[model samples]
Target: MVLLFRNLALLLAILLPQTVQAELVTKYDPVIYDPEVPEIVAIVGTIDARTPLNFSRALEEMPRATEVILASDGGSVLPALTIAREIDRLKLNTTILPDTGCYSACAFLFFAGNERASSGELGVHQISSDSGDLESGQLALSDMMDVLSDYNVPDDVIVDMLRTPPEEMHIYTPEQLATLGIIGTSSSRVAKPTTPTADMSKKDLAAAFVQDFNRLWSLPNAQAVDTLAEKYALTVNYYGKSLTNFAVIEDKRAFAERWPLREYLIEPGSTAINCDELTCRVETIVAWQTSAPERGARSRGRALQSLTLVWNGSGFRISVEDGTVLERQ
Candidate 1:
């Protein structure tokens, strides 16, 4: 992810001010960490003329990369298409992981995938020109549609993209992708480890994961950095704060020190889990009670938690954690 946002802006200005500006999280280079795609090429930021160069550099360095992961808001569609053809030429799978977003021309990069998957968000809208007449816009739009047809984007999806105004967006979540037959549940789904239905469904697995998270967090040792990092990514969007897993661990440690004793769990029947094959979004209500004898205080409350979890072969790991207090004492 681009932690150096200031540098990213300067880089974009130097590259092409009108077309490329990165509001993305990761990089356009070789990264072999993502569970899928042993050697992964992640293309984020904006797709400018230089995008193809960076992409080529990544592939030249990591020829074994079986997939390209994208999380771009978008940039020039022309350059994006150039990159897409390269991805196709190399026959790379494409994916979008949780907490990331793929939009506008970025959709072309995704559509060109040999095997596509998305656990994040994908958004589309009408083709736009910063300085062009209506006729020009129509011509551009028609050309875009033709190219998307060539890329094998679903007709309905393409229609939705064309219909969305340039200023607005039509967004598709992983669940929507599943409904569109673009994900694991799709008719074109390739072989994957069977999601054990007899033992536990995905929703059930999500609920249990959340419940276990709460159980672990209620412990005095909940702040154990390594333990917390095991469930949550090293980088997390905790509530709204961008925090490292260690920072979050310390935060929990402070809470435990303040409360002394506490119990927390997901409220019964309040779990709502949405999933595709690779990611899950779980929404649930957490009830908590805390006691601080030193202050002679007792507290009870409930909060709604929104969690984004991604599959890592054996189990899920949280990528985003957000909550809203629904009740407090």
Candidate 2:
């Protein structure tokens, strides 16, 4: 009887399920885009089972983080939902840059942002179970709908999400995203400058400034540098003398030669702008790297800089710049 009991116990142990360990592969880091602006917390990689704990740790480490930038390929569902709720709870603004990609479960967290903006792709697909069970799939879909509803996502958007298959993706365009209230909303918090421009709204001008600045750093060649320099007034200085005419091209080329491969990483929501009728000031922290790591001479670091832009009748141009570049410790 004892032997039979032991055999039965062994069979039961073999049949019963064991606790599954959380698989976390997400990378969280603090990014200071501008010393004067609030810090941005970056969350990258796959949101797996361990993401919830990882995100919790990040929040605990950077309690002052008021914004979050996400670049993820997606992963497990429950953990993503947990992260989304946490983001909502913290009331952080979330943003995805034009070069970044957020998909599947990552979209959930993006949608949960109190003030969300996406200049890149936000992809979604139906939720499914690994076992391909219809009941489990339905339950998963239902749970997703519940969360989406809680986030106040539109019914049409939720319908489209349901229609998309797990194997395929439905990427939301900027226009569609606007309709979904994900972007294009001007913050009431932005104080209007004493002299606002009539030609372009402050929001549009700010967007243009960010886009142009990004383009300027992507390929810091002679032509790119020249275009950026043209945006600066003739009185703008490089080292000491003004960067005007031939001096502009020469100085830019010299700088480009030193840093053959330059890259600037901007933290989302780190851009702070103050514009008046004639001038605007933009400040941000940038992680600037001016070397090719593959070539064994890479020097990468962060700096805080401020650009003063003046409206030149037709458009805005840089009038002055605080040349101080404080390297990040």
Candidate 3:
């Protein structure tokens, strides 16, 4: 009788749903939310072979989600691959949160999602051994190639990617990955309104300025900078000079001091530019003319332009940000 009771207890434990385990674990490792992004389900931690078990539960327990937010450094390849397979099977949308990334093996998971997106800052490279050295083992290379093949990654790309040392494995830019048909269109580049017309009062303008400035500063890409400049009717400093030479800087004061105008040019993220009579802004973007970095045509070009403005009830003020290179200026 005693033996039967013990056996019954063990069976019950084994039959308990994995969802219960997820609930228990989440109490210790909770997912944090970003108010700026309300729709994303943040997955914050190292993703390894062990992650699939918890992820399976997360998927089962969380409400039917349109997208999954993944952020992690590379971990065990086998487990990452498993997670990737599940993401594909589920046809879930995936995205990398800004200032976060899915590196190394974790990148494979990103590619497997039905629709891959990033807020910004998605880095990918190669895997190294536990000893922090390149795995010269034949099996490691073969296994890596197998994993790449599972994702339908081209052999040539795999060869070129692995040609570098593990420490120097090439990272893919969002554009590069998109061109390769890996991650789909990126969502971080969309233009946003700086402020609504209804909130253009003095206190509101100042508050919105600081808020937008901080957020833009966090992801200070040239594209974002350009959008902010256009919405505000501002000018960017290019090589210590004004941006009027390269691009059209709108004359908002001449148009009329107002909150919302009829026509406006903006960059990717929609930031409502306030080109009135009081404050102004501008943008400077340095980019290569060509795709190949070694080619002279690919040399970085400095472009300056006007972006934003504000109505001080007197005259327009232009407050443009500095044109500093985000990478290899």
Candidate 4:
């Protein structure tokens, strides 16, 4: 009896942790950590329904984490959406390191990140149905839109993303992503070119954009992009952005143009301020509306557009265009 009891106790001890681990697995399964960025967890492999257990397990462990590195060929959608929401809640940065690819449901996960980035080859395709019919395709599109809406993706943009034929996928670059607001502006945090030498004649907006662009690609994540954008007085708005080659070009141009008129929201009692064409200025305006007198009055406000200014040897050039401003006093 003594020997039997001793064996039972030993077994209990061994099984306790396993049981607890199994319970945790119900919500989360497995997660991988990298020694280089110990704060960053690497999530690779099929992220489908089968993988959700591991994904959940990893998420519960990673909220306190700084980053999540994701790379997958694609898999399930519902689970991926759930995983993405957790990433957003943790406010952790989601990135795809260089040469890593995030496809299908994995791409949706990328959208959920507070900061989303892709090193290279970030592919996002339309959702398909198990039956592979137009009705199924429509259903899948509707579902993806719902998921994107939860993440604050603009309805129009989500619609555009779904435009891909059931047969084709939507691939994107970090810059293309930033414009649409699908990928946050945090990607700009990478590196930026400093003011040109005294003799340099031209504005290196392209170079500057490129520097930030590469940085985002190097460490794709929503936080990183947001950090960079904030440093430069830049912000991204995805409300009306879309996914298309032409749309991509237009978005980049919007960044390059940085027009205050197009960028800011104008309201009564608001003033626009575009700093002088010098002094590496950031252009923006503030506006606020007093509530009308009747019953209870409320205040309305909006922010104007902002420009990232840099000293060109000739003068100041509006090198970068961020999001439109809102009403603010």
Quote each prediction's TM-score: 0.46, 0.45, 0.43, 0.45
Question: Native-vs-model 1 lDDT?
Answer: 0.70
The candidates, ranked best first by lDDT, are 1, 2, 4, 3
The CA lDDT of each predicted structure is 0.70, 0.64, 0.47, 0.50
Which regions of candidate 2 deviate over 4 angstroms? 1-38, 184-329
lDDT of 4 by residue, 10-51 (tens): 222332343343321223322554222335565656665656
Clash totals in order: 2, 3, 45, 30
Residue-level error in angstroms, candidate 1, position 68: 0.7
**Would you list the clashing residue pairs of candidate 1?**
1-25, 2-25
Q: Which candidate is the best by lDDT?
A: 1
Model 2: residue 267 alpha-carbon error in angstroms = 47
Worst 10 residues of 1 by lDDT: 29-38
What are the candidates' C-alpha RMSDs? Answer: 14.8, 18.3, 19.7, 19.3
lDDT comparison, 2 vs 4, better candidate = 2
**In candidate 1, residue 179 scores what lDDT?**
44
Q: Model 1 misses residue 297 by how many Å?
A: 45
Q: Where is model 1 more than 4 Å wrong at Cα?
A: 1-38, 130-139, 184-329
Q: 2 or 3: which has the higher TM-score?
A: 2
lDDT of each residue in 1-329, candidate 2, tens digit only: 11112232322222222442322222442121222222555566677777788778766766777777767777888778888889888888877766566788888988788788876778888887645788877777777878886776655456557779888887775544753445633352222122235876764675566556655755736335544544566677544566664566566677777777887767667778887777777787777777754567777777766777777544566666564566743
